[model samples]
Target: MRISTRTSISIRSCHVRRNGPHRSSQNAWKWVASRSSVELAGTGGWLLRNGKGLAYPTPAKSNKSMRSGTLIVLFQPNEERLLSAKAMIDDGLFQKITLPSVCLAQHCVPTKGGTIAVKPGRVLGYLDSLKFRLSEGARRHSCGTFHTGTDASIIPDYADFQLDVRTFSENTQKLAKAAVERIIRKECEVAGFPTTPRMVTVVSSPAIYNDAVATSQFTRVFEWYYGRRASEVVQEMPPDIVADDLVLLALPPGGMPIPYVYWNIGVTDPETWERVSREGELRDLPPTHSAIYAPAIEPTLRIVIEALALAALTFLQLL
Candidate 1:
């Protein structure tokens, strides 16, 4: 893909595919980052493309970067989102939005009127992980993942997490996986995407996960991530191709329900949710990292649920 004049911006989308090499048929698209919000870098140059996927390389310009974000929910990206992203010379969306947040008790009620007497922050914790390459900041988190789709059946996804899993092997893995499961289901059950923002590189990578779960945990992680039995979303979201950042979009058909429900939960680490501070008394603690896995479909539903619930409660009080 060539843009003669900077004004003639044309960014083509790439779907997820196999690990195989780029085909001769694949056209190269230029991704030039903006030096200033109003400026474009690649006035005349071939944008770099390699194993790392697509990028709009910008020259060292103004010392600052514009990290604007957008969240959108649509069946498919209409032309506008793509154009908006390209026009901005986005670094990459995957890296920009995948952030792990504290899982607060939003919808549920005051359970422990008779509920378990667990300390606040102690019984509730959110944990996730990310692994990357040997690029600029490759030593730590990756520069964002490859397009979820490649030569193989292409698909993509993303989200974020932070958990502390230590002690017995089973306990750590189990609790970690449980948090992931609840999140995906709840996300699919509650919220959604932003208005529609482009992507960006992290400029740098921090140690994404010194406490990343072992590869053995892949199956269990996949199960919880999709809120389905293992391999449920495998065809589209294969495990091997997954990288640091995941861009999942849940649009059109407006929203949907989770076909899977939690029939039973294994023994949960009663103390897993406790929040720990570096200054607080030290105790034997397990390693942890943020898991940013964004699934477009579920999060959208999650947002809808929250909105509806608030509306309902407001209506009831009126009566």
Candidate 2:
């Protein structure tokens, strides 16, 4: 099998999205460099400011490879903040490049190393993060009853806390949010508060829905590469309780929904995987986002890079 080397790639800072509008492609490209933040790179070398990164590979045959079309790899940031995708849309991402036929994303998980975890629908739950601050009026009266203050003589004037709710469906999310608000308000009323506590929504994101057809197509590529049954190549993972902002990338605001698939790559160390499995300690393995969590780098990177190339080729019809 032959692969073409001609491809184009560009890297830009996550801050660019929140900065302002991009009048032109050249103007937008200026914001690519970022020194203080971590940057993720693909197989090709760094995507420099001088337009130096390769995008995709195609078959060497000139005529056939030309039919595969150009590939554009976008490395986005701010996913932890749940605003990367929205920021890209607001910054004219589609305007700067041709609208993509499909979008793909992957994340590293604590699953056994060298395996992939994916499913066709409802990969992750919806998220609603809220911040609340009880006013001074309520705190003075409530502190005595709630025992919120350390000093016996002085009553606390205010209290603040954050709440996060996750569910698999929009209806459930709505119900949960309403219930939380009702409980908080009822408590405030019982305390004889003059004013309601301040409430602010920190995040509101929908559940990630994987396109069935797109997921199947990608699964076939994995099966072919691993020379294994589809079930073995693609782990039969149920919908995860975690939530992410990647869904925002697939469903842009005020735009038609695009086909997309998001999957998790196993990143545990091989020796650790076997040891834990043998001792029935897999349940205790450190998961993503934990302070002690760390993945074996070499094979994890190899698997992810291959998965990306295979998926790209499948979508481009170059396979």
Candidate 3:
């Protein structure tokens, strides 16, 4: 086999519908060819490396020469809880597999059908789940009585449960954490508690900053291909919704500093999208994470496949 330089690509998805055809994988394999392969047992992931000895013909190719690159696709499970990604890293995912030069991921949103939305700079923010515990006396005395009149009694020891904080910047994340801790401590002091309230972090995920140059280049390409179907959204994202995969890729072990792109594609049908568009709000739309929230599958799959294939080909040309 001929030895050639390899460019690694990584694909990750939070959720994959069961019992449906593997449209993305099939389209990807058909679009790109490779000589060597490695599969992750039970995860349904693949690592494909293309060398000079093997040729994968594409529309861009003039001759029969093969392109040099590697593509690693990772399908993450347990998307609802967002825990499987962290588990994979702890198990040494990047250490065992080839590291990608750049990482790419996309989400299905409730926007108008065929629309692609993206933004520069910080595409997502940091997410942290904090828990606060307070004794019965602290709660009753500081906040309020459990009941009124004769029925009034001290509240049982309780915790604030899960308080989620999303910060757009690292500095903001630090300030938010500190402010939360300070507020809890002050409440305990005011309640005359013998000890300070306990604070715990249930989960923490960092923010993602897209590379400016790379983002601009891709935005033009998307607009050129999709025209009116592509857009750049200026609205802020909800803080509690953490993008764990991109955050994990930005950190150690993975340590990929190259440009990373995170974009959104609409999953709603044309009729529903038109209705929501006419209404001028998403209140009528089924929001993500809701039991009723379901995306139109066929169109979604086709759009996603096309976007991924185009992105891979564009990046390969640069290589």
> Candidate 2 has what TM-score?
0.75
Writing each residue's lDDT as its tens digit, candidate 1 over 113-220 gives 111111111222222332221112222333244434343332233323332222223356456556655554555435333222222322211111111122112223
Rank the candidate models, highest lDDT first. 2, 3, 1
lDDT of each: 0.23, 0.64, 0.54
Alpha carbon deviation, residue 198, candidate 1 (Å): 31
The TM-score that candidate 3 achieves is 0.68
Give the per-residue lDDT digits (tens) of candidate 2, residues 1-319. Answer: 1111112222333222332223133333343323212243332212221222221222212335345655566666545567666777789876777656787767778877777887898889999999887765534335643335667666667677888988898998999999998899999889776779888888888888888998898888888878845565568657987787766666655778878878887878778888999999999998765545555543554566566667767777766
lDDT per residue for candidate 3 within 20-80, as digits (tens), equals: 2322445334433322131211112221211111122232243225444544455555444
Give the TM-score of each candidate.
Answer: 0.15, 0.75, 0.68
Error of 2 at 184 (Å): 0.6
Number of the top TM-score candidate: 2
Scored by lDDT, model 3 comes in at: 0.54
After superposition, the stretches of candidate 3 with alpha carbons farther than 4 Å from their true spots are 1-65, 80-82, 136-160, 227-243, 254-256
RMSD of each: 24.9, 9.5, 8.6
